[model samples]
Target: MTNKLKAFIFPLALTLVSPVTLGETLRPEGLLSLRELPIEEGSADIQRLQITDRSGMVLVDTDKALPLIENEYSPNSYDGYTAKLLAERQTKITAIDLQGERYDLLSPSTRSGDYLLLITREEGNGAYNFNLRFRYDATAKSFDLNQVLLNENNSECDHSLLSTYSIDRKILGVISIANFDGRRVFGVLKELRLAHQTSGNMAEKLMPETVASNFDAALKAYKVGDAQALKTLVGYFLSGDEDGDCEPGNYIVEKYYFPQKVGWSNDLGFLFEQAGHYPEAVELLQHITRKHPDRVVAYLNLADAYWALGEREQARQAYGQYHEKMTAAQKQARIPPRVLERK
Candidate 1:
């Protein structure tokens, strides 16, 4: 295995064995225990489980059609039979939901006093697993189905979802990992905001509120030329002191900070330049150009910043690149006069 694969697999392996316990009851009042109902003779020996209220109304049932396992296996074979047996034996229940129903609930804090129940079921010869999430509603005195997460591991590749919740911020950060090519891995982290008050369905309540809020704040700060405010916003999202590979702090920047805005680094560079912070502008503009080379406009902004910093040769090179990329009409009509002069 490569280092990147090891980085992802090792921490996950430790989490599976040493789960972080939240020490809170996820079960709400009126919802009875999760009980396993006996399988009928014609039901093909598959165990059925149900979550019922005090009034015996079934809220969730594993016997019903499940999204992941509906068409996964064929009927009545030794391999299929053994798969079901393994699934039943390996089924796990936990307070937090993540990683194909693995029991670990890793988070920085859980002070929101919310409740969640997770049930993970293995399917189809132990290659696929499904995690069912249930969140409690205090007002209605019931549990709401939140999400169904999947983890698939086979000879070809490994694909899974990992998540963490920040109760104070009311943000749910999810990381999706896809390792299809042997040495190349791709991962994306998305931060979702939960409702302020847990009254509605989780699907409807989850949104990118924080992302919007941060973006608006940053824009406002830039418009007002408030360098201090912009710096503070950057610190909030980008600061991390953790030591290790694949650390959660590292992803905080990746998910909540850098990816939220279009041409974010470039915009920040402009904001810094307007505020007379020439060095910061040069650094940020250079970063964005390297990170997103296809963003043609960044070259123009970078050239101006370099000129402001008295780097004449570098500024000329950037101006030349921008001049080459612009259409004839743009070069004549839109290109800044200083760019043509400098190039």
Candidate 2:
């Protein structure tokens, strides 16, 4: 990418939108409601349930609804959506009391006309036992039980769920953690289908050439400070396979782009950092250090990101690594004054 392209992709501002106020009723015609019931007759355990919408339309009455589990741990794990709901506590759901029962309502910030209602019950050990999910379709104006996503984390095993949304395509890509044999692994969950593309259009394909062109376009948009266009292009590239097997854009970066350009991952990490996505930058930089340990500049970038996140010890470690790898001349000429001062 050129300096102009660099200018385009790097300095975009992030706007924070306050969440919509949610009172006793949900949005889109108050189409969802919650209820609480005892686990058994006279039992202290309670089940926060989804009975119907505010309009009294029954959604699902059965508690034994089969949930969608992560495919990797199938026969072992619950749904990937459940894992995501558990991991991203800040963005996914919020605790609210409805008619004396505590329920986890999907965060109002995520409201986009479509609604996802998650019902969960906490066990004595603090892990979730029962999980249910329901969806409200804005177009159809109907509420229905979508799927159960059950995930229970315990002392012997752990799970993580990561999800990224595509604004342009309205797709959600989920990565769920599962233990296979004795090792932990990540598996992609089923992804929403890609929006229809014009047939016979080579430009729409995920081929290397097409991806390269899109990358250029994204860089150009970034240079021009077209946040929407840049994000759309990035989302298009990051689009996951319909089969939920892989991310084509990430494949292109690892298989084609990185090999073609030395230190490309480092450059990308730096770009993410400059864009104020510190966590993303840190993740990318950490990956680069593990995959291409010889990329010395990545250590400095990683340190910068760690420092930005107020992780002083991690930042110090990264800076020390970078310092140890640099020659005296390089250190004097290229190292940032901040790194030297911190050291």
Candidate 3:
């Protein structure tokens, strides 16, 4: 990305999980698992799963709803439990607010300790109901469902909800959905508050200055259309070096870091495309498409970049993907001349 590198200050709120020191390397055993539980043969449609606490205790079992008495930690152990359905065919389960309005349910639950957050759709109405916070009470050994209402009540726009649930150093972060015109790119929203934590009593946690400095160098390299510098940046992050150490291969940046910037690299790809940096644009745009397969614009950009580079097959595939995902309106609106004239 050529724009000046601006450090993202995380606005975090702490959840009331068992207190562990911040930055403490939590053993893998001390982490709750929210992975997709495996499915049985011929059970392709069934989305059964399990939620376990950091101590490897089963807190919520979709197959067997409520009062998880035994910790049967097996993907196949859910045979006896009834899988809780999030939606019915095309419909979803939602809730009524004080105003008696309906909304769509959020997806891909967020879990921290004994607490699990799930968003379900309200049937008939295509909007989310509310954020369901289920806390596992050890005393009762039963799960309690608590309703966390969303503050915004703009019922006119039919707003879509997308969530990226993350837990970083004792903090749970859920970025909401942000739509951009025809793009409707889904990512972690700007709200920046920790998911499942209602309290917002935290200050901005800035990225280390060293990390910012390294990113600045990468940005400078990007501005000048230097492929070597771009590759160096990728290597630096993947090399497993400490955070902020930019030595050729000594910085620790998660591969997901760039994708999470939400439209940052996409904008940068346009810059590179305009500058005729086909190789650079192709590399960056390819990364964006892989990170967000639904972002059709990224594919369009990649198609253009590839076409410019004379990689005909790659360009054709990119163009195909872009065209396949386009809505009827997008297909009719401002058709790409290259798409129409493709050989």
Which of the predicted structures, 1 or 3, would earn the higher TM-score when compared with the native?
Answer: 1
Please write out the lDDT profile of model 3 over residues 211-240, one tens digit for every residue: 345556766777787867765754432221
Candidate 1 CA-lDDT value:
0.42
Q: What is the lDDT of residue 41 in candidate 1?
A: 30
Task: Tell me the spans in candidate 2 whose CA falls farther than 4 Å from its real position.
Answer: 1-210, 217-262, 328-331
* TM-scores for every predicted model: 0.38, 0.32, 0.30
lDDT of 2 by residue, 185-240 (tens): 01211111111212211111111334456667867877899887766765553323
Cα miss at 222, model 2 (Å)? 6.0
- Superior by TM-score: candidate 2 or candidate 3: 2
Write down the RMSD of all candidates, one decimal each: 15.2, 19.5, 20.3
Question: Which lDDT value does model 2 have at 287?
Answer: 71
Q: Which number leads on TM-score?
A: 1
Error of 1 at 65 (Å): 11
lDDT of 1 by residue, 1-343 (tens): 1111111111110101222335633222454445444332333433333455568776544432211222235443211110010011111223322233333332222222222333334233333333333444546544444433332222122222222222221122221111011011101111112131232123211113344456568679877878888767644433233332233222322233232244665665665565555665666667667767667888888898888889999999999888887853365578888988998
Whole-model Cα lDDT of every candidate shown, in order? 0.42, 0.42, 0.42
